[model samples]
Target: MRLPRSLVGWFYVSPLMLVLIPFFVLPMVVIITASVLEGDGFGGIMPFFTTQNYIDVFGSGLTFNLYFSTIKFTILTWVFSLIIGFWVAYFLVFHVKNQLLAIGLFLVCTVPFWTSNIIRMISWIPLLGKEGLVNMILQGLGIIDKPLEFLLFSDFAVVVAYVHQLTIFMIVPIFNSMARIDKRVVEAALDAGASRFDIMRYIIVPLSKSGMALGSIFVVSIVMGDFFVVRVMSGGGSASVVAALYEDISVLQYPPAAANAVVLVLVVMLMIGLILRTVDIRREIAR
Candidate 1:
């Protein structure tokens, strides 16, 4: 006996739904419900529904600053990651003479991920801090009169840490996409008197849009949802939306935190929607 096609489709999808319903759907529903509810000025929530939480979110001046800072870091991280990742992937896929060596180098790049993220970030402090290796080197070389205060616990350090952590996200997807390209197509273009720049512009970039979009989603979502990185790296000097939510939760302001979370989800969804419009990810993956 054969199942109906729609039924067969559902069979394949059921396992995903099992995970999504309990973890994704239920949590989102709870958050949405909590966002409109009142907080009891303690660790518990009240049953009363109100829009004041959202009102507070929009009305506060700090919200604007938090968003601005987060967005600034996100853009910087994205641009740097894309540039470095694309070049690295291009070189590994196209220029590297020995495939084994290229794979080894790629693995070397990913060695940092083997350690905990907190450990990796903490390690950077010793390299970037006032009394850190970088400062000592510069001082020894007489390159500076004193340690640069802005190198470690400032916006610069935050951006550096973000780029360091997120570049791998950009690289993996792009490498996969580029590796899938038919080398014959590139050779054909080359034979047609096409410049390397033209091939990259018209062929590589267009083909890799899907990978870039996927990588962008990962970077944006992680950065937007992160509180600890900004808090720890910036040393209380900068903030993000999630960091603000963390502060609210610490103060027993559940409704406000929930409201902030809801708005952030909406914003992220909007950004992802815009990105999806540029590429048919399913079709690309199938190809």
Candidate 2:
């Protein structure tokens, strides 16, 4: 029997709504409520309400700086990851001759996901530390006499750490975009006397804009709110917004933690809203 329009619409949307209600809607409501009130992450919570926590987050200049630093990391990580990732994906999509070889190269990017994020991040310490592999290798090669003290615990290292983790997030979306391009278009461009750059600029590049956008969205959001990477790499979470919340919670400052969580949610939503406005995710990922 043919379902009514309302019924069909309900059938199409109920699953998503069901998932959202629990995972998305409920969590936000509880969190925001917790922000306005007082409660730890466990049982026996306080139910008192106050706006001081929200005010405190805004009033603190240090907190604002931390927020800016996080945003800076997010922006740099996204931009660089996209640039490098797009190039790699483009090379694979249009350059690799053997399809299997191309697929294998793409799979190499995802190997990080198989391991724990904590383990992977800690692994970086040995390579970038003052007495570590990079400095030793450089010294061995007569590159420099002094070990770079700023190598491990600086913004540079933090950004590098983020990019290492985030490049795959950028690459996968771009690769998906490249995969959908009609191969005949590339051949047609070549047949029409197009140069190598012309084929990329005129055909392959234009088609992958959606992928770039998708990758930017994924990379930006993940890097912006990441705690562990910034905490470990930036040295003791000194200026990390996420780590600020971790500190608050560990110290039993539940209200401020909730407030930070609220702010983080809003920031993420703002990012997502910006992305959705730029790219119709439905059409981009439909294939």
Candidate 3:
């Protein structure tokens, strides 16, 4: 009377499948369907199938420009966040002798996240604006004669906002991986005449690859999909692929927008797949 093992596994996962099917899979199916349909000049869709939407998306020069801008910001944010997050996690794991204090310090990092992301992003404006605190402080210090125009509503601001928001995603995974390292391994390496840099290069970085890969996935996905921060922070001077998609949807260009969405989803999945190929996350987590 016993059921098959595979059937039992499926039974256990049925609830999750039900949720994903209705919420995730169904929506994706609808989008893919819409992407292949024809759109009227107005805010309507024709009952016809065509590949023109994909063609338009791929043929447009604006598409390349938008992707280029987005990728530039993505790389800048990823590099800076990785550097800062790695050092912060390393400091907490290796230097902090008191576990309670390290935990307290870690909790401090999460305090800014208690507020909404919009609020956190907007908070940078007052400090970075032309007449804001930074400029005022510079003037008072006699360091500059005029207000810095590029601090806010520029590419600098976009990268700063992105790094501030996304660094925590990097920290959590890296911290978890570094925390699991045995202190004895480090001590033995030191006893064997290994330099600090050697220990870091050989032991720490290799073991932390899983964490870095996980964090990179988070940073890359979020940065690529975001539009609001780029639009607002760049003062309409820059746009990302998602921003163009938003504009298309606003103008009732559903088919083209859906096509862009499908392309973006594919690109993101490819990036994540590359990261996964670099590290076996499931096995690392199992350890």
**Highest lDDT model number:** 3
Which ten-residue region of model 1 has the weakest summed lDDT? 113-122
- What is the C-alpha local distance difference test score of each model? 0.89, 0.84, 0.94
- How well is each residue in 98-207 modelled by candidate 1, as lDDT tens digits? 98998898888888877788877777999999999999999999999899999998988898888889889988888889889898999999999999999999999988
TM-score of decoy 2:
0.88
In model 3, what lDDT does residue 75 have? Answer: 94
- Over the stretch 188-222, how does candidate 2's per-residue lDDT look in tens digits? 88888999899878887778888888888888778
Looking at model 2, residue 125 earns an lDDT score of 87
Rank list by lDDT: 3, 1, 2
Candidate order by decreasing TM-score: 3, 1, 2
Off by over 4 Å in 1: none
Cα lDDT for residue 81, candidate 1: 88
Question: What global local distance difference test value does model 1 have?
Answer: 0.89
Tens digits of per-residue lDDT for model 3, 1-287: 99999999999999999999999999999899999999896878887999999999899998999889999999999999999999999999889999999989887886887779998999999999998999999999999999999999999999999999999988999999999999999999999999999999999999898999999999999999999999999999899999999999999999999999999999889989999999999998888
Where does candidate 2 have its weakest 10-residue lDDT segment? Answer: 37-46
Please give the lDDT score for candidate 2: 0.84
